[model samples]
Target: MQRFVSERILVQVGLLIVAVALFASTFGQSFSSSDLAQSPMFFPRIILVLWIGLGVISLIQSFKSDEKTRQIASWPRIGIVLVAALIYTNLIGSEGFFIPSVGFAVISLLAFGIRNPILVLLFAVLVPGSLVLLFNHTLGMPLPTSRFSYFF
Candidate 1:
């Protein structure tokens, strides 16, 4: 099996599993009204249904495609990124989004062999900063904010 086929099947299967789990969880929530329009589960169920549908489509497509794309992920880099992500998740709540995310971005960039200081700093700062702005300010949704980040 080609890497492309394996990766696609794995992703689609994972998506289906997760979507089913989420759909099942929606059943556990208590609804004040049983009405379709008013029930909280209504929107979630719709979204999950769509997600499951997409997963099925992707799975079917995976078998049909014979593209021999040679792109492969580096295990060492992937492991480093996974560890960084785990650490970032742990730090996000306590240390807040900006500080943890900046550190995470820098580590991720470095792990990928991005040694350019200017690009590192630019990406490390811009990505997280834009996310904070998008979530916190633009959308009126608050992400965890560091006390140190007076402006962000």
Candidate 2:
């Protein structure tokens, strides 16, 4: 007799609800209905609502189904993905978007098994090149020249 509700799924659903509630409570502090048509809180509140709704759906789905199955999660693979994201975030301020973005992309692809050296090199160049054009030039948020701007 297998349990219908999974402990891990329940915990995750609960955490999601808590996170959504926290976001929702902070909404009133940053935004009011009259602040603007598109206030800062508008997007966050919408996201919070969606998150809570999904959490509820997850809870219901978990309970309504039975016969739980499990698969082994490869921690090394997960760690590699997280490390890539962190590298991108950390280098974004110092190295600018170009180098860090390209490096992160290439490393991420390799972590996921893109073994061909040539293909990995192309991906590294293309990903950051696209980002530079899209965000720096097209979006007008030019990449910072150097850390000297803040260090000084």
Candidate 3:
């Protein structure tokens, strides 16, 4: 079987390495069983473990994936996404997460060649809307919002 050394594999490897390094760094933190939530390493360790696990799975999948199915990413689309993400970041404080996220989703989807207006509108709204509801309500984690936060 021919091995594929693509960007997908590279990303998985990079993520795995970064996760492992971060996990290792967590060992220096004070671990107190008394208050798991209060421990500095608690969230980091949890996230790192998840990241490492997912990275390994992705790396294995990448290795097993058929080379014929691999689609090369568009450099121009990537640039658009990067620029859109930067704009999204700046818009978060002023325009709020929901607005910026929807806008970003639309732009990114368009950049990646999704031309269906209905699908685009649905995805752009639903994805960010769900996230907003989940974070703002279900998890009790308030995201950045404009003055009329709930209405957004």
Candidate 4:
């Protein structure tokens, strides 16, 4: 039992259980009777379904493989990224989404060995700007605005 529990298969099984639980939790969500299309729960449910399917496929693939091959991740690089993310999350509310996200993107790209300044600058600007526009305008979601928002 101990050996089985420690196998790679158990990790896949755990993921499957988590996915199923996430899908199940959304079952109790109530959609609007007037417009099911515009229901708030629609997108989340779709994502949950996709997650569940992926989990099942991964579990099956795990069973098919005889040897468990795990790649060693760069812990220092990962730690730097994690710290950057934490700083971004904390600063976003106070500094607004754009600046903190741009800073995070640049730091992350640099950490991942992206040496080209032009590419990094383009990505750092475009990605966060696009997300800010998408969430704020298209989805009618409000993002944190800086005190100097008027200047931008």
Candidate 5:
């Protein structure tokens, strides 16, 4: 009964939906037919749609959960991960993508209770490296330029 709703997931989904809707409204305020294909509304429309989908999924899964009891993760751990992510974003432009991203991942993994150094290191490197390659190289989507200019 108590476990029916995954409270944390629900809260996040709701917040995301609200944020997307707000941004979509703000950005789409002046959208018109004459605008180009990649107008301001384009990205907001995509995000809003995805946010709605996520919210719906979260709502359904939470209502349909079959478990009678479950161990909810500690809020402190999630808070730590969120803080680490903020730090990563703040540092990425000044330090570099690799260093800040790896630090963020490692800290997040540790917060989530994965204590193995090898696994943490692997994840820290792999995820950020893949993102850097895919977004920066393959897609040509420029990320924040690392002030140190160490790697692409």
Candidate 6:
């Protein structure tokens, strides 16, 4: 019980450190007054601040808690998803968005214990397809494309 609490405390501290680092990284970003609201750094700064605040709160709570609760977390699943995301990031530029994103979605869902093949297939296709359409057409943002670009 004590070991579990200590482990959770370590995780909370790690998260707090990461959040602080992210918040600090945003300080070097410069945004013009005219485009401050539309600046690329604006949203990230906001999110990082919120993340830091949450980390602080969680860290405080972890130290204050007396409950002897044991949490069962799937750390391997997390690792798999992280690795898949890294691969997906690399593939987006080389293999284009559709194939890599579908693969990522499928792998991530499966890693998280989703077993329904039909649902997984639907999500793998629909999510990326919708995002491609929304970003490419509606938002006018161009995504990476391969030789089969015409299909999208």
Q: What would the per-residue lDDT of candidate 3 be over residues 44-90, giving only the tens digit for each residue?
A: 78988999998888888778776544564777998999999999999
What is the Å distance of residue 50 in model 2 from its true position?
14
Q: Write the per-residue lDDT of candidate 6 for residues 1-152, one digit (tens) a residue.
A: 66445877888878888888887887776667537787777888788888888988887777788754576588899899999999999989988999899999999999999999999999999999999999999999978986788774
lDDT of 4 at 69: 54
Look at candidate 4 and tell me the lDDT of residue 146. Answer: 79
Q: Put down candidate 4 lDDT per residue, 20-124, tens digits, no spaces.
A: 888787767665552556767677778888888998887777666566556548877888899999999999889999999999999999989899999999999
lDDT tens digits, residue span 61-88, model 5: 7666664445657879978988898888
Question: What is the lDDT, from 0 to 100, of the residue 76 in candidate 5?
Answer: 91
RMSD, model 5, all Cα superposed? 8.4
Model 3 Cα shift for residue 65 (angstroms): 31
Weakest ten-residue segment in model 4 by summed lDDT: 1-10
Model 2, stretches more than 4 Å misplaced?
A: 1-10, 13-74, 133-141, 144-152
| TM-score per candidate, chains pooled | 0.56, 0.49, 0.49, 0.50, 0.46, 0.51
Preferred candidate (lDDT higher): 2 or 4:
4
Name the regions of candidate 4 deviating beyond 4 angstroms.
1-75
lDDT values, one for every candidate:
0.86, 0.74, 0.85, 0.83, 0.75, 0.86
- Candidate 1 TM-score, C-alpha based: 0.56
Worst 10 residues of 5 by lDDT: 1-10
lDDT of 6 at 64: 80
Q: Rank the candidates by TM-score, best first.
A: 1, 6, 4, 2, 3, 5
- After superposition on all C-alphas, the RMSD of every candidate to the true structure, in Å, is 6.7, 7.1, 8.4, 8.3, 8.4, 7.7
lDDT of 2 at 73: 79
List pairs with backbone clashes in candidate 2.
Answer: none
